[model samples]
Target: MAYVISDDCIACGTCIDECPVGAISEGDKYSINPDMCTECGTCADVCPSEAIHQG
Candidate 1:
């Protein structure tokens, strides 16, 4: 499954650079495009708020 950004996201833009597939997008809470996400977990590793997780 792809990783999902939870409401806990702080929109810090940290996860964007960590996504190797560029699946992350900036927004009020940031979002991960499941179609593009590779489920690499890089974003989750870098998320300061621990908002990204397996979905």
Candidate 2:
């Protein structure tokens, strides 16, 4: 499964730099491109809001 960014996201842009596959997109709450995600969980680990998780 790819990592998902939930509404809990503060859009801090922390996860963007950590995504090895560049799967995260910036916006009001941010979002993960499931098709590009590698499920590495790196973004989840770096997310300060803990918004990123496996889906």
The candidate scoring highest on lDDT is 1
> TM-score: which candidate is best?
1
Model 2, position 45, has a per-residue lDDT of 89
lDDT of 2 by residue, 20-52 (tens): 878888999999998999888999989899888
Please identify model 2 stretches exceeding 4 Å from their true place: none
lDDT of 1 by residue, 1-55 (tens): 9999999999999988877889988999899899999888999988889988999
Cα-based lDDT at residue 41, candidate 1: 90
Clashing pairs for predicted structure model 2, backbone only: none
TM-scores of all candidate predictions against the true structure: 0.96, 0.95
lDDT, candidate 1, residue 14?
92
Q: How many residue pairs clash in each candidate at the backbone level?
A: 0, 0
Residue 38 CA displacement from its true place in model 2, Å: 0.4
